[model samples]
Target: MSFVTLSNSRVETTPPVENNSDSGVLSPEPDASMQEYYQLQMDLLILTVILTGVIFVTVCFFYPLKIALNYLLGAVGSVVYLRMLAKDVEKLGRQQQRLSKARLAIFIGLIVVATQWNSLSILPIFLGFLTYKAALILYVLKSVLMPES
Candidate 1:
């Protein structure tokens, strides 16, 4: 463990990772906590896909097929965004890197394309992109409302 002092403040950062004597590089094996983190990431993705399917089917029943298809496109984008976010998070401490804005760029690009394309409806697509957020909220609520035995 290491700490740096700036002025009067003490800042804590990722501890020095053990280096492999032969390779002279950081160990590639992840710790146990990373396994739990990976499971959480996988769970969120699964929940988002399930939610997207249900919402897409509901939209198809009430709206035109075109709108439903637009929403599906955005849902796919949202999945990509979530995957990128998870990768960034997984790299956080281990790699000692800052979070990237590529995920936000993806969302912005999706919106821009949706707006420019005459066939795509912006509202449904935007709503579809928020599917991941809904899944996050659900996960939080579930964790708070239900605890492991």
Candidate 2:
């Protein structure tokens, strides 16, 4: 492979020429930025899971088992919700997606509110939701500070 300079600040890789005797098919190269983005997403997911576990264990020490379980469930629910949203956004670009952030937040909030009215505590659920938001904030910050090359 060789590097091609498009501008003073940017350089791109040019695929090496393959022998004609070999298979004519060209293999695709993996994108570095895409790999980095996926790695960051996985890291955020693992961090969220660890935070949820820590919160659950800490709450368990002070609260009853049932309440502790409720907190864990809420955290898991938030994680699932965020994952689903990410999948949806991936499948359909943000401009094409019908759901807005406000709508998504309201929908999730309603679900949590329903749970609170029925049985579980609102504070724990809200805290769990905030954890996901924190992860999102971190992701945005990272992206802003270190843009893809």
Evaluated with lDDT, which candidate comes out highest?
1
Per-residue accuracy of model 1 over 81-133 as CA lDDT, tens digit each? 99999878876865656898878988899899988989888998899999999
lDDT of 2 by residue, 9-98 (tens): 887545333233356554454356444544665677876787788878998999898778767766777677767665454435423656
TM-score of 2: 0.57
lDDT of each: 0.83, 0.64
The 10 consecutive residues of candidate 2 with the worst lDDT sum are: 13-22
**Per-residue error (Å), model 1, residue 21:** 12
Per-residue error at 7 for model 2, in Å?
A: 43
